[model samples]
Target chain A: MAVSVLTQKKNMPAGNPVERLLAATADDMARVNSLILSRAESHVDMVPELARYLIDSGGKRLRPMLTVAAAQLFGGGAGNAVNFAAAVEFMHNATLLHDDVVDESDMRRGKPAARMVWGNKASILVGDFLLGQAFMMMVETGDIGSLGVLSAASAVMAEGEVFQLAKTGDLATTEADYAEVIRAKTAVLFEAACEVGAMSGGADAAGRAALARYGLELGNAFQLVDDALDYGGQSGALGKNVGDDLREGKMTLPVILALAAGNEAEKAIIASALGKADASDLEVSQVVAIFNRHDTLNRTLEKADAHARTAVEALGILPESEMKTILADVVMHSVRRAS
Target chain B: MAVSVLTQKKNMPAGNPVERLLAATADDMARVNSLILSRAESHVDMVPELARYLIDSGGKRLRPMLTVAAAQLFGGGAGNAVNFAAAVEFMHNATLLHDDVVDESDMRRGKPAARMVWGNKASILVGDFLLGQAFMMMVETGDIGSLGVLSAASAVMAEGEVFQLAKTGDLATTEADYAEVIRAKTAVLFEAACEVGAMSGGADAAGRAALARYGLELGNAFQLVDDALDYGGQSGALGKNVGDDLREGKMTLPVILALAAGNEAEKAIIASALGKADASDLEVSQVVAIFNRHDTLNRTLEKADAHARTAVEALGILPESEMKTILADVVMHSVRRAS
Candidate 1:
């Protein structure tokens, strides 16, 4: 425990996240972090280099936040969400690191990916290390329903990834198919995000289901918006390259919706553009224009609005608090972000 | 249960593997084709297409055999080794799948690597799937020591991979460093093989430790032999090209020992062969001749012999039995083959 002082902040930040959250969720966050480090400590000495590299990478801690918050929302226990949060975060990062290794993508946010910095092998093995660690965390939670949800969700996520890989670069994907893929790929995290919250918060069956539904809908909208931005936005605003998704041959919602609304000539043109390694800048511009014409951007925004409304509705069972407002804001950010 | 009659083997082989391992691990080579289809059945719909495709593609299954035989040697328990066997097998395959993806390796055991066959993303995620499944299985063993050995070994194996990647083509690898890598990379599984067995079979502390030492030494020799053969054996016999490890810039035992023994001229030859993508046959031949003259092959074999002997020595704690003989023969075969 002497080592804990080294990591503890001498001057803690001003914002009180747990105080803002329902049922002392900020305290829950502190508790979760402690458990995560403790659980990870078993693996720490053995992989001195990788364990240090990955944990110190400073992830945003969004997934774990959702876990604890959901638990608080329903006015139940704090400990369950802490474990769920740690476990879910572990699973999330594991996939991200592995995704980088497979895509050979060089960057994560603004920094180099774990694979780029630590090499692909550590990126992968540490990813695995986290995955196993996640299960241990889940088991510690001792909630069978919670376990069932997380396990089933994780399996589906893997399948979704496989489906995405199979369809990548192919122009045959429809808006519906793209929606399904993104739902599996990204929204499940959102779903887990909300469901784990309520489950840990000790919401009754109907209440917990409501939060899960909210999370599922919100997650779907969030990913659709992300796909749209990855295709349509500029790097200056997005902090990443536009059309990076297209370059990888990923047929996102904008592309799929645009094609469905376009004439045959336009469809064929878009298909040809996707096939080219160097589809002209002019052609890419034309596709973007077609998306605008089809009102795909507006439609995506409308869906996001629906998810945000649903996200708030899911928490209706909870007594209103400042933390509740933040959850609503997070949902807004998920679906409504422009860049 | 109905599926067995549905998916029944067309021609099941006679004789349990316990009876055949004494003939040499090589001669008994074939799929046990059990536990996998049943245990992974929850993901069964995808099994034929996704899970089974790469698994049945022909792997050594050495880890599982080590697990099963180790348990049997100590005295059987009620289906305990079955879980241990499944756990080790899953861990081994998980490593291979991730390894193939990271290494960009196209072939494994003379067949297409999982990444090459199913695409890298599937290989990566399925590897995650199996890993999650492995932890789930190991937990059912109801022994914390079983969980401890398997999880710790998983961490070590992963770290070994990271170390190997970091040290690639670095001429500084000594025998001790190589030994550490091999212990982590290979010996940990061997140790798990024996530890899991002893625990499941109700062996006492002394028996368990002795068997664990046997597996650890056995794995070390097994890896040493594999490394030596990568440089010296026929491509046809090994089912991979000679010096494939060198081609990939992997610093194995022979290469490290050879480099340590070589003069400036010999070192120059090895560097030229390894660093170039378009490495010429003439350059490779020159390095091979230098290795031949340095007696690297003989020295490597001697080391393998010493490890194999140590493995057998560890088994001295066990009472004389048919199981012990089979395990002893396995240690002999580990280093006896030229390839």
Candidate 2:
């Protein structure tokens, strides 16, 4: 009863970091949203229709928010930040469209995935369309330095996704491999989003580097929390089913830790369910029980908290401001979501 | 027998324009090849493995040659031409990968598609990796104007693909739609390749526009020939089955013209075969017989020839050089391939 009460209280946040960040960046974000909508448009009907489905789908748009917020933190009031923010969101949404196809995902943002509604072909092409528009927006900014950051990040993100695909369902996948995957597939975009934002905002060298580090750490923490939530959090909150990563044979931290700790019987049970597309809810529950027995979820959350702390600390170099404080809180709240 | 003799003579060119162009730009092309190979590489083994399989699979390497040749015509000797050339090739290969996935193509360049070898997921990711690398190379050149040209072309190309997909099997698809499709899917890249090459080569405004129109017309000719060859050329030469466009339900000029002219019985036969993945060789031949009755293949090639003439005329503004002669001959030879 005491533990349950503690969990309930922890889940109830006194202040919502995302809401605060959104409020703080609302003015800039409106421009970002408009840009995202316009850039996603195409003369091809399917291009705009499919793109709008994913773009207008209730994504948190956190990556672009980070871009805008980072720009604001450096006193950026120009048009470049808006462009960069829109481009970052396009990159994120493009990846989402492709990721859904790669993962054979059925739902995204609490709705049927674009692939499901439009088929894998549409998903793949629209993803490419969005990616092209993203670069177009970046080019419109006329900032080659920031474009370089985003382009390199795009390559690394694809590599991370490929590497993760190769390692999928391999029980021997190491923590190092997982780290590389998250950094490439998830964190690098966050890093680029912030770095480019800072660049657009006219941040000095040190300021830019600080924001990059902050973004990288936050991305790492964010992905770690996501991995844990896929097994521990509610489906309603996640906009996806629990144990999806497990079913997909994703060698996430919780599963890696559980595999390392569990006995032969437990390992066999987990392996049977891993990568089984039709993995039953009962099987998922059984796996979660094993994860609980090993305390892997909590251990994963601990790792996430460490990353979140580092992310907050990375911003220490920046001059204190309301935006900076909100940014730090966003990192903390990212990890706390796993509770 | 006379028609067959004429076809054989037309097919066997006394001097291959592609070979001539290849020889003309050998040094630049060597750099382009090296850049393509190096840029396609990644720490992720699968990235290079899949990319190289397609890149090295004996594509005529025509687009990059166009880039190189366009640059050479301007009397420019600089590294940016090489970069843009390689980048154009990367963009082309990336599209090939995604196109195979979208089209569910079994063979490319007389070999199994990357999607067939590594699965659709790998093809999509590696294609993305190549696109990212392409942009990175463009950024490295620090030529934002050319980058803008290529990036906008990328968006338009994607739109072209999506439009083609939507109109597949619609039967109501028009000549204008076919024109739009081929321009978007094929010609725009050629336009960008040449335009960017001219820009990189320090061409004057008129020179650049002329080269752009040249590439655009050449691309139209190239794709028109490709459509005809899909029905009328040898598989060995086309590197794909006869009637693949029909099987894919692609409303190319050949098919659209035939459909518009065919009686109801002929239309029924074509409709039965259109979009049928398992469409037999016998069915393909039947469709080809109908195509011959209407002489649609020759008409498509005639259209291609017109575009080829326009392409050559577009280059009339430039000073005569060995490269310009070879470029104009390349367009003529592209049309002749379907004879």
Candidate 3:
């Protein structure tokens, strides 16, 4: 098995790692997608309706795909991976629903957020429904260790959100604080997703730790790039309006770096626009110009690249495999999306 | 043990069944309380702040008490009950936080709702955090069976909330629909709480099933009386304004009964008040007057009494014990609260 995987890695496909991971795990993910939809179903019409709306919405299902890939990396394609993958997706979707409500975001995936369409109350409750369903799926797997990982991740994710909420609109928000926020909110789940998937795949302790480290670093890179993209990428490509993080007063790395380096006038420009829901396009452009002047966007991308490198390096301890190679490339691809 | 319990039951001294249950389970409950507080703590200031506010608020802690009592009833209380009990309370509090946000309720336990003080976003997030913690605690117990019970209960509870949301302000709601909603939203958790408590207490299958049935019926009685009290009980006693259900457009048994029994003119009066955020005291009184004319409040109470009777009867198969007696009385006391 090891020799075959090593042979495949030498002639790896030269395209998007995400697409490759998807193709490799398509059969497993097919089961995962079905389980996700089936579990999201409820006797209550609105639950399935709202859940399906968000589930079918254009999320790359990247998190779940990573779970499958990690599991497959460990020679695991047994049924447990499918359950963990579905649970991970539900956790992600649950966060998205709540985050939209928290950020008061109008758009998600270039469509009106579920909160906007169904109202915040529905969004909040349905988010909860998804979360409850997530735990239920995990419990069904009867994998207490993985359940522990995911549950702890869920709590940390919520803490990250609360911490971010507390720091919103505070210009004194430090880069360290921003890092903690992102690590808690985004990267921790990635770490758990990969770790749990590896566990499901029957990875030994060392292999599990390596995948966890890889996932954590990759998640950090993934989020850093996303934060950067929020400012630098086109709205169409990002599937969310640029300046949303700014408008939500999210103290992402770009804003943190910009605030650190900006002069008094530039700082004033960013402050005026920060957390202002109705901050006009012109005002946002002014903030963006200051960010450009400070080159904070590029600087953020640099940090993401560093994390991506660490993520790939984390994979070095593992034996060569097509899935492992694909995982490494996915990390690089995540960072490169900013460019 | 059975003989000692039987002796105590013959000489049982109790004024209120709730107080009796509390005293009986006091030692175990202290541990459960501590677990609840410690688990609710987070490094993030607001997470604990909001959680403490809700936890410290004057909730009767009835759900957790039930868990403790049920465990004790089955000749168990080694340690698992404490975890299950705390998890039960967290689940209850999580739902309370979310329900307040969804209902736009201003008051809970005679204080400003957590949403009112900390904002809906914090409530939603903290609620999620508590729920995550709940699952984490359950995972620690490593009891997959209990975890399954609790997780499935959580999903059912969410479904109940959504079902209730959809039926809100719909005058066409039937008693059967109302029963389903309450079962999902309220009774299901109670059922699971007792069942899991029994499991942790090392109960055999029959005992577990009996306790579960007792809990379900008791929960039904509890909610039925609560709904009745929403209109008939005083604000101070209820810890919330009377007619809250009416203003929130909750189609409880009382409302469903009143609607089915009211004349055209009375129906118009109810339709005007239903779902009206600013429903005046006079308008509420007019609706209450219609309920009085049809005796819908008492009718609801009568339904509660029936459930309470069944709850008590479910315990008949168990060996005679003080805890069993107290459990039966608590069910009666729960319904008696309406008067």
lDDT of 1 at B227: 78
**Fnat of the models, one by one?**
0.26, 0.78, 0.75
Per-residue lDDT of model 2, residues A190-211, tens digit only: 9999998888788999999999
| Per-residue accuracy of model 2 over B1-339 as CA lDDT, tens digit each | 113212333444357889988888999999899889899888889999999999999899999888888888898884798999998998999999999999999989888888888999999999899899999999999999999999999888988999999999989999999999999999999999999888878899999999999999999988988888888652213234877888899988877888999999999999999999889988888888888788787778778877877888898888877788788778877876776
Q: Model 1: iRMSD? A: 4.0
Task: Summing lDDT over every window of 10 consecutive residues in candidate 3 chain B, give the lowest-scoring window.
Answer: B1-10
Report fnat, model 2. Answer: 0.78
Please compute DockQ, using alpha carbons, for every candidate against the native two-chain complex. 0.21, 0.80, 0.75
Clashing pairs in 2: none
What's the TM-score of every candidate structure?
Answer: 0.80, 0.95, 0.95
Ranking by DockQ: 2, 3, 1
lDDT of 3: 0.86
- How big is the RMSD of model 1? 9.3
For candidate 3, the TM-score is: 0.95
What ranking of all candidate models by lDDT puts the best one first?
2, 3, 1
Give the higher-DockQ candidate: 2 or 3.
2
Whole-model alpha-carbon lDDT for candidate 2: 0.87
Best by DockQ: 2
